[model samples]
Target: MSNEPVGVLVIGAGASGAAFAWSIAGAGMSVLCLDQGPWMKQRDYPSNGLDWEERGLGEFATSPNVRGLPADYPVNEQDSDISPLMFNAVGGSTILWAAHFPRLTPKDFRMKSDDGVGADWPIDYQTLEPYFALNDRMMGVSGLSGDPAYPYHEPPLPPLPLGKSGNTLAAGFEKLGWHWWPSDSAILSREYEGREACINLGPCLTGCAQGAKASTDITYWPVAQRKGVKVRSGCRVREITVREDGMADGVLYYDEEGQLQEQKAEIVVLACNGIGTPRLLLNSKSQQHPDGLANSSGLVGKNLMFHPYAMITGIFEEPLHGRRGPVGCSFWSHEFYQTDRSRGFVRGYSFEAIRGLGPAQTALQGMVQGFIPWGEDHHRAFARLYDHTATLLGITEDLPEDTNTVTLDPELKDSHGIPAPKVTYRLSENSRKMLAHAVERATEVLTAAGAVETVAEPLMRGAGWHLMGTARMGRDPKASVVNERGQAHDVKNLFIVDGSVFVTAGGVNPTSTIQAFALYVADSIKKNIETLFDDA
Candidate 1:
């Protein structure tokens, strides 16, 4: 019902949206952010409750495919074995992500040049280096210096203690003569910017009640709000409405009460991740854009990618204190991160040293992996796993394929009566080969570390956390949805700053890169406001 036009209308308050909103709003723009999920207070997080695991199963389930919350739109993944996982909240998936922050290596930007496979990023790492530092300060990252794998950058805080599990894994990498370093994390090691330090409450994925982990709800949103950015929660955007001139005009969304409303804006920016962005565009079909808004290339929903994951566990004879730090990986190896034609995979993978699973998670995973049976032997099998396991997860780089796509479901609809996103993805032969090689290398490292037994799973379903490349960026308008600055090639007033604009999925946790690219786009928009507004 409102007819006021804001300076900028940003959809999705997740990592990319938060960063862009904060950057643009700080420059004194009248920015308004909209998110389908609620703004949960710190006390409302599952970590504050006694039944944390039970809460995870119901309200805070990591995967949208599993949680099926009313706020969450369903994802139809019947054709794909790897299900998409996400959290619908003010902070977006940051609410559920383990705070492990790793920057994409420089080589990742030049995948085509380095490996002769996959598309090269339109912009290189050097162009994004300053933004990476800017985002690091904004997120308050903690890590160690002197990493040979990087181009010399210092983290804000000293690395969080490796603890017993991290030290165990570090020793394994050292023994094998592989390059390893302490992981950079978004969780605070000491109080900074009025946020408290981490108390080592174990799992960072359940949401940090202590305000140590830097979710956008506690970090960028607060700062952006203080800078006069208006964030409206519980509003699900149905479609991006375009003007008669073929430019984005506004968005049609359902309010918390399920009433349709339109908020016009001078510029429309989409930070709705890969799946959400494509789905929204696909659903916005009109006479102007017969396919979808700004979808002239017909590539909006194609090239969906999820980093193929393989988890390997090692059983040690001696007890290792596992429940003392973040459950996301502590130490990581880039030993096999670069392309090696001898390995038979175009791109490479990273080895993340994850902590051993807790009792509940151990039992759950053990049952699924068939390591433990029900009834009589269950207790004994569980006892063996307790405090005696270490895990290494191999994150493989997934190349873009036109077949891996996000389409609109014909029959399935969300609680808001919008068609749900239909995903169809399959592991490429390159990915399968990469997983096989990474598992073998990881097993070797674990065995070298004096493990009595080792168990490895080639691939796990529902490990699709890094949703990327559905609306990729490139110089060729025909090949990409967006330009180098995240501006849609077809619509000058429309921009996208999220994983959806990734040209290539690198072999690392993508949040760091996602935030950095968002900052880059925001800065680009700020610098070119006159040109951007002139087109309108």
Candidate 2:
């Protein structure tokens, strides 16, 4: 074992980990970032016109972490339907995210106080606001100012070009007398921070070839590396090593070739996404802490929440020119972001009016939706939907529930011989109601916007993209795994800075908020290093 001690050991190179590493390294900490995936470059991204299967390169059926582990999303052999989607790469999920960077509203933090649901966050929106601004600037978010929905923050850069779909949505909002604003996106409209502007490539999901979409590889990770943070890719951290005194010392992981290795550190920060962090803790069973490293509270893997979502598509008579911009370019009304007394649901949803269907995606979508699996009808349906289809994707807030959890499947181990993180999530009744309400409103909005045909795909239980609240941060140590500053309650030198700390799933994409919270936690760690080490 090497005696070299890192000031901070950051696990996972996703949005939170990258931001945390950057902030700490900028503060002159010796940071070592370990990612369970390999680094991918712009050249590795597929060409704009490639088919979906061909374009999903870095995101293929190969497990980047454990060699023979099944892909995150497996294709059902009989039904041929794709399962859950997750990207394994240096940039993590940010490589395939839509880049819709919306700030969490004040109500999101005080959900317990304002509404009778969920736990209140120890920190409020005001405390996190500055960090949000800093994260926005770091990520090069482009947007206009004056969203009455959220507290004021200076716009990082000018808004991206409003394409045909955005324009139509804007018109519909105007007609309905509802407030609408340009969706804040992490894509560069103009070259900012030396990165290039978006060349209007429509597909932002399959990794941004132009370096415009703010993946961590282009944003924080590079800055962190330049600032002396050592990033080691293809290192799958399986367990957090804890001292007898209940302090995190380092981690045990596997190298690219499945060789087991251990790294020591003064402080261990788990910025691995919600699923990975809990799994690491559960795997790290020591004599002092039998359940997990930070499982004294027994809350490390409980209270899982993912924003229940619904997709409502509108088929217009005229071609909407959907393929001219990024998929997450537009916004719908956030008028229902807060809890409405009239609605049975406890929280609300944000409607994002977006353009869909790159030529290949459109063809696949048409086939799945029963427009003839092949032949001329498929081709015609593809062309029509490619140009005429617009969608309103509703990101509804999902209440945290202990039942929806990430637990270790005792029977299922990965290729690394470590048990895989098993997600057992079921949507709450409130979430179901919210999704139903969102679908209805979305259909109304599409119809009002002059859609000749509309189709609504309401998400069932367990169908959500926004993962959060596993190792939640709160005032009560007994009730949460981490404290307000994301410090683990059980392990003095351990921290969890990610969506897992979120108490509630706010009605927005969580990337921006996750990054902001990571930066905030990094600052907290820097300011309280003496206390953290001395107490340990």
Candidate 3:
């Protein structure tokens, strides 16, 4: 063997990266994981009684005052227009995610066959079902199965409790003859796997202080670390260093102090999220591939997707106590997930009734409604809307189009003088139609549930959180960046394991699919490691 390290180097310590490292290390391969964020413990999260600003919750939990790559040092902007809300912490966005872990229906994979609109995934839902089950078990998801709209799901350890909103929505669904079921969430309901059950604290998006949510920091990362996987935080990988033969050697990154360092490995895996992965590939310029590393197909940053979300808020007459439970617990409507050409949309969407707001958030809502600037009216509004109000959020699927893309901004660069990823995206006609359908459905549900008032927010270009389909995987090398196995078509030892490899963006959240794809890629890497090293 050469003097260089004979292990795997994984980039981005988020869900996919952490899961990949854990799996690869569990397979007995030495693994080095790098994250551009800090290692945050559970104690760092906020408490219920603490002030929101003092608690350092929300955006402050992951982003700290630092100067380095985009991960270590966030792009600080006063205007929300210029800022992209993401975590720069070890667990990536999972640290602050709402922990809604719904699985994609079988129809999600074969969109072309079912919808005749977007492209189909190279692999079907059956091929990914086993991995999905594995992920649910590993993450300790809480849900009940037997929904007629989807294939039978594996039973959860303990079903999550349904709050008032859930019960009300369920009643409405039954009354209206619409399909509804309990949402699958990565939350503890009965204290399985040595973790405590949820206390109905409603702090999931701010980081679960009670440890009920299954972020990678609490799930796979700990197991990987215990199994001897080495994780180095504050390490931002800038480029994937390749040898003359076009095999990936390792990576070049800047350490915490902004010092440049390089590590050579037998294999290099890019687990960066949809945005970061394409940025790294597009920045790694070399003689062998001038456009970018693994850009021989020129499909590095095309087909960007985000699930268009529409939020419908309903103000009730009595307090519903929305601030107590998980953000996305209780009732869900997947009745429209299948493609209905009659609706004038190629794809479909799901409706989820979420819990109500906390004190501070309730106060903000009152302010938005032009309640008395402060004092009596504000207090009265807060008291009335605190428990009674409910929100039904829609996650609409977006079809992949070449025009939606992530490209380098020639004018903007991070602290390290590297170009930032400029997203130029627009909702497709299909997506617009889907959003309209979702709004109409949500309004009808709220009205049926006896909602006194309702307001609908339409889907904007970047409002959706489900990011995918950038460095897509397919059978054709000329049309896709990676093959079906997630191996870069232009490079042998390089793999892109994240939402960026998605050929299609399903209606559900992308975390479960991302983890399954990582597992699939890990299996391929394990089977071909010897040949890959020999080629290197």
**Ranking under lDDT, best-scoring first?**
1, 2, 3
Clashing pairs in 1: none
> Model 1 segments beyond 4 Å from truth?
1-3, 533-536
How accurate locally, in lDDT, is each candidate? 0.89, 0.79, 0.77
The reply for model 2, stretches above 4 Å from the true place, is 1-3, 26-28, 57-84, 372-376, 460-463, 533-536
Ranking by TM-score: 1, 2, 3
Q: Give the per-residue lDDT digits (tens) of candidate 2, residues 428-513.
A: 77877988998988788777888888887788332344668999998788998888999888787888998888888888888888
Worst 10 residues of 3 by lDDT: 75-84
Best by lDDT: 1
Clashes of 1: 0
- Winner by TM-score between candidate 3 and candidate 1: 1
Write out the backbone clash pairs for model 3: 200-324, 319-387, 319-388, 320-387, 320-388, 321-387, 322-356
Give the CA lDDT, 0 to 100, for residue 406 in model 3: 74
Q: Clash totals for all models, in order? A: 0, 0, 7
Off by over 4 Å in 3: 1-6, 53-84, 369-376, 460-462, 530-536
Give the per-residue lDDT of model 1 (tens digit) for 318-348. Answer: 8888866888848888998988889887788
Residue-level lDDT tens digits of model 3 in 1-536? 12247478889888888878887886767888888888877776776447753454334543332223346433323221212345767888888777787777777877777657767778877887887888888788888888777688865666787777777767767789998888788888888788888888787767888888888888888888999888888888878888898778888888888888888887788888777888899989888889998888888888888787878877767656677789777767888887777998777888887898766766665676654268656666556666777888888887888877777777677777777777767667777788888888888877787788777777532243555888999888898988877888888778889899988887878898899888878877877766754433
